[model samples]
Target chain A: MTDYTPYVAAVYGLALLVYGGYTLRWHASYKKLERQLASQSQESP
Target chain B: MNILKKIQPLVGLASLIVLAVGLWYVYQAPADFQQGGAVRILYIHVPSAKMALASYIFLTVASVLYLWKRHEGADILAEAAASVGAAFTVVTLASGSIWGKPMWGTWWAWDARLTSMLVLLILYKGLMVLRHSLDDPVKGARATAILAIVGAVDLPIIHYSVVWWRTLHQPPSLAAGANADIHISGPLLPPLLILSAAFILMGLYMVTVKARQIEASRHLDALEAARLHHDD
Candidate 1:
């Protein structure tokens, strides 16, 4: 009908931002977890 | 190598490949006759919607396992899936609303599918609050598992909402039929498929990472508790 370019951009942009933000958070948390586990294991070892 | 070490590379690489290929397809796909450029929203909307449902299913199964066997890891997995599922649900609802405005002439309707999906998000948030509030892990795990199990009743309602009720939303084209197959048609299929795969890969990576975070948090919390106990 009308130009749906904005709607398309909004959806895709939102998707990219959400996925990217979450992935970064996941990576950071994973690194933190690894460090925690390492320190714990070292203490016990 | 440890499990995380092994999984990290595959997860990272797969997600990148999926994102690259999926976006390439999105760029190349043709416009729909009816919805025109707005149809692109389908790539994200449909996949995230389905993944939201898929995540809930995974959470339900994991919750059942936790309840049945009393395994802490199962509880961790269930909780992780719930968190990811909630995130996906927001994407689905947001994209759907944005797309619906021009297509359906309204941002939202109090339709069955939408309502049930909202309920699912609320349930997920409630579970997160429950997990954090309860000091007793054993009691909390059991309670949350039961809540997850009960919450699963919404899944079928969300899936069949269009068919079961008169709604603005269309019924699913989940399988092959004489007139239809996948919800997407023609050139849109390639990009949509690639994107769907990418979203699923990313979802797996998120869930696994979240599960590990929960476990690590638990360990750190335990250490904190023990240190405090010693000081006392």
Candidate 2:
């Protein structure tokens, strides 16, 4: 049997790394925006 | 609950299912193929290409909606789709090249599929640059929408590139009702299909989230501008 371990690992690894990074970035930005909005609202009141 | 608000979660759930299915398929692929171990790349390359195509199609639709409805949501969707599509397109090209080097004996070729894909990357990048150059959001949206509509002409060309020109790249192997020479049997097909579905769902979900972010950012900017005017 041809060993497909390396190819499989590469594919999954890259997908997880890239997509995971994106998810993290999205969460961070969302939190930052929420904080900013909260601060602005507080200032207004 | 608003229908539009639910789109993101629905897409997220669908994408998760797809990712699970893809994992199952990749583990079960047959070992008898000529490409042997490296055939696993198919799962990624095919799905990424499909996503790239789908992104451009989505952009085209959003462009039309922007022109007709003048809706900010549509413009934001187009921008988000274009950005994600460009990333997927790059992955497709890179993975395809890696697979081709071992199988086709070259890292690059003048094949129609390859050339057309490169053109798509360029067009997407150009549109993104155009969007960022303008200070006015409305003006940027209008200009980018027009560019997107014009650039959509390349979509059909990319789709038909293999048919129109004699190239090194093989014709599509997954056409409906034809499985004569294609080796998409057993666990491979399921995972590949599942991954494609997952990518599409994930792409849509990301686009929706990005669109909302853009809208919120614009609102914040407008509020800031108004406050500055009041202070003046």
Best by TM-score: 1
Q: What tens digits encode model 1's per-residue C-alpha lDDT throughout A1-45?
A: 599988989998898788778767876896787797788868855
Native contacts matched by each model: 0.74, 0.22
Candidate 1's displacement at residue A43, Å, is: 5.7
Alpha carbon lDDT at B207, candidate 1: 85
Docking class of 2: acceptable
DockQ (Cα-based) for each candidate: 0.70, 0.45
The TM-scores of all predictions, comma-separated, are 0.87, 0.85
Q: lDDT of each model, Cα atoms only?
A: 0.79, 0.73
| TM-score (C-alpha) between model 2 and the true structure | 0.85
What's the C-alpha lDDT at position B161 in model 2? 64
Query: What is every candidate's alpha-carbon RMSD to the true fold?
Result: 4.2, 4.1
Candidate 1, B92-138: lDDT as tens digits: 88987887777666788554556667777888899888877898988
lDDT of 2 by residue, B1-232 (tens): 1354577778778888878877787778675455676767778878887888889999999999999999777887898888788877887777766655555556675555666788889999999999989999789899999999888986676658654664334455322111221566665577777887888887877676666566567667877998999899
Q: How accurate locally is residue B62 in candidate 2, as Cα lDDT from 0 to 100?
A: 93
List ranges where model 1 is wrong by over 4 Å. Answer: A40-45, B1-5, B157-183
